[model samples]
Target: MKTVILVALLLLLFPIPVLGGESGLVISSYSVNPSTLFPGDTGKLVVTVTNTGTRSAEIREAVLYGNGLKVLSPGYSKLGTLTSGGSVDLTFVISGMKEGVYYPTLVVRGNDSTLQYPILVTVDSTEPEVLLDTGILYVNEVNRINFTIINPRSGDLTSIKVRPIVDGNVYPEYLYFDRISGGSSAKGVFYLYTTKPVETVQFSLQFNNGENVRYTNTTAPINSLPSREIQISLEKYPNEVLRYDTVVFSGNITNLRQDTIYSLIMSIEGDGIVSSRDVVLPALSSMDSVPFTIRVTPISSGTKHLTLTYMYSDVLGKIYTGSTDLYIQVPDKDVLSLNGVEIKKDGIELNIIGDVSNLGNYEVKGVTVSVLASDSEESYFIGALAPSDFNSFDINIPVKENTSTITISIQFVTGVGQLITIQQNLPVKEKPVLKEPEIPKKYYILIGLISVLVLVVVGYSWKRAMQ
Candidate 1:
């Protein structure tokens, strides 16, 4: 009986080991309400530690560790003494964690060993929304896209970046958000100017929590602008004249846009000549033509090219240029004239003389003299004459008794069919003899005979009278 009592007492003193909660500390229930939370969102974790052991266990403190995550509850409760089954409930609130899945470790310290529990916290962020004023902007025009960032959480947002994607390339300029007082929203403006028209533009908004949101829009088609149309025409004083002093250059312009053109410049350019002018043309329709004129003084003789350039504007306040070309001809000046003529006779030689003058600005070539007889069928040709000089030629004529009157015609002929004519008359007469013709012999003899007969008869009569 003593051995049985001793064995029973010893077996009662040493208890058998149990699988759970030998130290009188147990986690009855634990849960985290909303395991996933965003930045600036409030969340809660509930933990129940129970004492199920036979002896009492002193609870020291509980701690949680993670960046920007903290425990709301402070100090560990001391359940100084507990019977077989006893429990304590603990609650914790955490705030201010970025977007990510995080493992938060909760440590419970006791007199024996430290216990750690990993709590999973998931942070989800909302993407921002962006709005654009115009999806398509014309060249050299302003592009303004508005942005709105909505934050549903309770914390203040720090920095935000907006990037524009053009043709699959990121634009280097970043847009920033403006602070909103007493609100969880941010508004920003993105202004851009482009010289080239874009087909599509995409924008991305990045928050401080490393979350990105993208938006895209298509631009509208750009309208055609107003441009200058220049038409050139050439006018002259006499159309058939090979040479002229001045030529008139006429141009027409049509402004196809609704806006008036200011300081519209027109220029004419050609070989060795240039002219320009500026004028203002009111807004005119495509059918309306505005006329403009410029005087062109010819410098030399040849074909001259005339180019016209004009400027105009479009509806979008853009400028355009147009040009046209034309041609003109200038003739040369004249420089030759004809002078008088003279006639002289030496024995049987007939000499003709004339004068020539240089009436032109330039020298003359291939000058000659031609003579035609009025009484006979004979013609004569003279040699070339120098400029501003006179030439004479002696022509021998075969004289016949039947040739009573001689008509002399003189002409100064240039090789190019320019001729001058002069005519004169010459009379023919007989030559005088040196000695007197012999007197008639019959008359002289008769006179002598008569005188002798008279003398004889007078002598015979006197003798007879005397006897």
Candidate 2:
């Protein structure tokens, strides 16, 4: 009777093993569904435990642990008894897991044995979005754009990278992000400006989850208004004049812009002329005539072209150019003439003689004659010549011992303010005489007498000594 009871107990305790002692309790369907989950997102973990042992076993408990992760449901599963071939299923809800790889532990306890199972889970908390304030912008205008980041998972985000692609070029330096905390949301602003008419800009965003997003836009047309045009006009008074006549040319500049201009500059370009002073003109203003004088000599009797150029900067810093031309006719070469230049021992003087039939078309102002010595260190200024129908100036230059050559620079200033200068060179020659000193004939006669007296005395003394 005891043997019969023992056999029945053993049979009940050791029901048919699933593998007949081939393997112990094993996990058949042990996995977490949707292995990847973002921050603040929920995921399901399903584990299937099976008893492959040779004897019946009881499963006591199972637990799961991970950094910054929580289980929403009971992680433990109790199996009262497991037949030779029996399996149990356990499902757990996990939430609030940080962004990273996570490992959870699954423990199963039997009446005589304990088993451990490790499961891997990944939580992603990355939200990368690129936003701009305006799609179009004007040239030379400031534009601002804003960017925001979003994290879907409840896990804390660590680092973020942003890149701006402008004009087909990638610019990593233009990116801005937050570094204080690893929050799922961040905000930033971007300011941009351009000088060109049209441009295109692009930007990209990357998150810790290895996800990338790109955005692009075309800029609007940049308008540049036309600047004001400014110009200088030159006019000569009594355009035509006789030789040795003075001519006056006046300059004036007008600002055509609606805004004011500053630093007006005026210059003259031509042959046989002078330039007026530079005048500053106000906005939308006209400058009065500025006068410049030129003296014409008989030598400069011909047609000449005079050009006056003016430049100024407007209020907007735009430069403008302006210019004008004038035609001047000098008297015929015969009507205006220089008679003759003469040099003397006491001083040098230039004689200028000219006739103005009609004063021509221009008035004769004055004349200036200058005398320059070839050997002189400096040229002497003979004041202005007397202006009349017949003009003449006597330039007296003091003669010096070393005066060898003299140059007379004859300049005629006309009544109309025209200048003409002529130059002439003259040579001065002088020879020096030296006299030879005379020697007296009496000195030679005295020396010969003294020699004869010495010879007679010597002969007489020799004869006396011999006797």
Cα lDDT, model 1, residue 452: 100
Q: Weakest 10 consecutive residues, lDDT, candidate 1?
A: 237-246
What ranges in model 1 sit over 4 Å off? Answer: 1-124, 139-156, 168-172, 178-197, 209-268, 277-467
Listed in order, each prediction's TM-score against the native is 0.31, 0.30
RMSD of each: 24.4, 25.4
Write out the backbone clash pairs for model 1. Answer: 226-314, 243-331, 335-360
The model with the greatest lDDT is 2
Instruction: Give candidate 1's TM-score.
Output: 0.31
User: Looking at candidate 2, what is the lDDT of residue 364?
Assistant: 34
Compared with the true structure, all predictions reach lDDT values of 0.51, 0.52
lDDT of 1: 0.51
Worst 10 residues of 2 by lDDT: 210-219
- On TM-score, the candidate that comes out on top is 1
lDDT of 2: 0.52
Error of 1 at 166 (Å): 0.8
